[model samples]
Target: MSQTLTSDQKDALQEVTNIAMGQAASTLATILSTFVTISVPRINIPEVSEIGSAISKMVGNGKEVTAVRQSFAGHLRGEAIIIYGQEGCRDLADLMGYDEDIDQSAERELLLDIANVLIGACLNGIADILQTGLTFAPPSIMAERVIINSLIDPTQLTWNNALLVEVNFTLEARNFSCHLVTLMPEDSIERLKQAIDTFMENF
Candidate 1:
């Protein structure tokens, strides 16, 4: 029987995210010089439909619904989505020195910049730690009403055809929230364990 990745997988995953997240934090810190620190939240595989409400609750009581979807694909192909209600995004944009009268084009431009900083840092973190390099396929903006099943293709990535291990971050100072979906391929599940086992053996 194949060994399942236990809660210990979460701990290991946290360490992996920690390293990448720290790098991401540093990059953001340099850009804004705001001392960014990403929190290590528990990973979740909630239903796709639940994401809107889940994220809304996280940002809480914002009049305008603002969500920016940025997707990155490579060896590990998936999305790194940033979401907030409209009010929250406007407030964040204003705080970040962006003006009002925001439209799709303007918003798209800003979102892409954020995704680049984040996804670049995120990929760098993974590559350095895994001792392998990962290439990006460019980020595309995701629609606000994306259904969960849209991205899950059994043929492309098989960790599971069902759900993704999602990590959410809330920027404490600016109250801007972002989510990272680290997709697991079904076939690669075993490979991850083997890698971890190798890592365990070293420790």
Candidate 2:
């Protein structure tokens, strides 16, 4: 895997997401009738093996997670996404008065609805500023015991290696913490730098 985004580039990334995440927080607050606090976005680019474990550690058990993937092409090119585990979703659901007795079977629909709201709000903010359009595959879930690689389609990857940028976030209602991860090609580093620089100029 190639580490293309340098420190400055990474900072630019976090800054861009800071604005988007705040927008997501606003979206959640209106729906749940509560405030949502977003932490400072941190940048993490992970290797193949590190991806699972690092992600596992971030969004531990007993939390609801929403994972989103959107490809970004421009001066800064890569996939931009958000991943929120069960914790925030459950808390938000509770706040919104959703059924508390959700089981494994019901999770399929539950997760899709959550992903639609959270990821949609986040990327909408991003696309508005970047003047970019993003495409998405339907969001799905792997059960509690499943490995991420097992569920992901292998054909989508161009190589054995991948570069992923992860930003940590905490939702305020009940202190739900999870990750927002973005993946991209090694060649996209330059584009990332340019995109960040552009965002910062306006910021």
Number of the top candidate by TM-score?
Answer: 1
As a whole number from 0 to 100, the lDDT of residue 50 in candidate 1 is 51
Runs of candidate 1 exceeding 4 Å displacement:
1-4, 45-88, 144-172
Per-residue lDDT tens digits for candidate 2, residues 1-203, read 45546777777666666777777777766755676777786656656556555555555533344554545454334554445554555765565556878564555565555555555555555555556666555555534433343324435553323333344444453776545555555555444456556876875
| Alpha-carbon deviation at 14 in model 2, angstroms | 0.7
Question: Model 2: how far is 154 from its true place, Å?
Answer: 9.0
Every model's TM-score: 0.68, 0.66
Q: Against the unseen true structure, what C-alpha lDDT does each candidate score? A: 0.52, 0.55
TM-score of 2: 0.66
lDDT value, residue 78 of candidate 2: 51
Looking at candidate 1, what is the lDDT of residue 57?
44
Q: Best lDDT goes to which candidate?
A: 2
